[model samples]
Target: DVKVTQSSRYLVKRTGEKVFLECVQDMDHENMFWYRQDPGLGLRLIYFSYDVKMKEKGDIPEGYSVSREKKERFSLILESASTNQTSMYLCASLTVRTGRGTEAFFGQGTRLTVV
Candidate 1:
């Protein structure tokens, strides 16, 4: 089975601090993504890395960045934490080569609060 793991299940940081959220997938998938969840906005994609060292900015990448140094690992960096950036962050992985039937698997998510 595919396993996606987030480094933290919950986090709290003061304003102006830099934060790092890590994610790893045991499955050798080709695609990994980071998304932030809000009540009204639903899940907004922050970044996507399709292959090692290749990444694309998603719909809500303005205040975020991502890194994919290894195929099994992906990291999300919050340059300067803020209250508005507080949300549930999720990591997902899937094999792009797979057809429509393939599905993405998500991690438990990290709930971050910026105070």
Candidate 2:
């Protein structure tokens, strides 16, 4: 079965600290995305990668960066964690099939708390 796994399901970090959130997919998906979920703002994209070593900033990328060193792995980095950054982080992998449309699979999610 295809699976998207997150390194941690819950995390707590101090303000101004560096944080790493990792995600991995077993389906060898070509597209990966990082998103954060807030109370009323919904899910907002932070970054995405189409292929290995290729990444693009998404809607809210100001306080985040991403790394895709391999096809199956994507990593989100918080340069300096802040209280405002506390939220539920999600990692997703997309599979685009010819004439079949695209399907996205998401990890369980990492709930990060910045103190």
Candidate 3:
């Protein structure tokens, strides 16, 4: 079974603190993505990496960044966390080359709260 694992299920941090969210996937997927879900705003992509050492910013990349050092591991970093940045973060992996209709497998997600 394809699985994506997030290091933490919940996190609470003070403003201005740095936070790190980690994700790993068992499937040797070619693409990994990080998204944040907010009320009404829906799921917005924060970043995605198509290959190792390569990353692309998504819709809402501000205050967020990602790292894909290894094929199966992707990390999302919140540089100086803020209250508005608090939300549910999700990590997903997919093999886009597996055909046009390939689906992404998602991790359970991490709910972060900033105060």
Candidate 4:
């Protein structure tokens, strides 16, 4: 079974503070993604990495960044937290196959609150 673990299930931070969200996967997937979920916006991709030290910006990348220094770990960084940035963050990992579809494994999710 593939296991994706998030460092925190809930987090609280003040405005202008830096925050870190960490995720780990055991399946050795080739792709990893970071998404933020909001009430009506749904899941919006913040960043994704296909290989170590390689990252691509997604739908909403402002004020956020990601690091994939190791194959099993991906970290999301909020450079300066804000109230509007408060949302549920999710990390997912998947292996892409040429001819077949692949399922992504997700972390439990981290609900962040900024005040």
Q: What order do you get sorting by lDDT, best first?
A: 2, 4, 3, 1
In angstroms, give how far residue 36 of model 2 lies from its true place.
0.3
Report the alpha-carbon TM-score of model 3 versus the true structure: 0.95
lDDT of 2 by residue, 39-67 (tens): 99998999999999999999999989999
lDDT of 1 by residue, 13-84 (tens): 999899999999998998999999999998899999999999999998987888999999999999999999
Task: Tell me the tens digit of each residue's lDDT in model 4 across 1-115.
Answer: 8899999999999999999999999988989999999989988999999989999999999999999999999999999999999899999998766888788889999999999
The window of 10 residues in a row where model 3 has the poorest summed lDDT is 94-103
Query: Cα deviation in Å at residue 84, candidate 2?
Result: 0.4
CA lDDT of each candidate?
A: 0.94, 0.97, 0.94, 0.95
Q: Is candidate 3 or candidate 4 better by lDDT?
A: 4
> In candidate 3, how many Å is residue 15 off?
0.5
* Whole-structure CA lDDT of model 1: 0.94
In model 4, state the lDDT of residue 24. 97
Question: Which runs of model 3 end up more than 4 angstroms from their true locations?
Answer: 97-100
Backbone clash pairs for candidate 1 read none
> Please, what is the TM-score per model?
0.94, 0.97, 0.95, 0.95
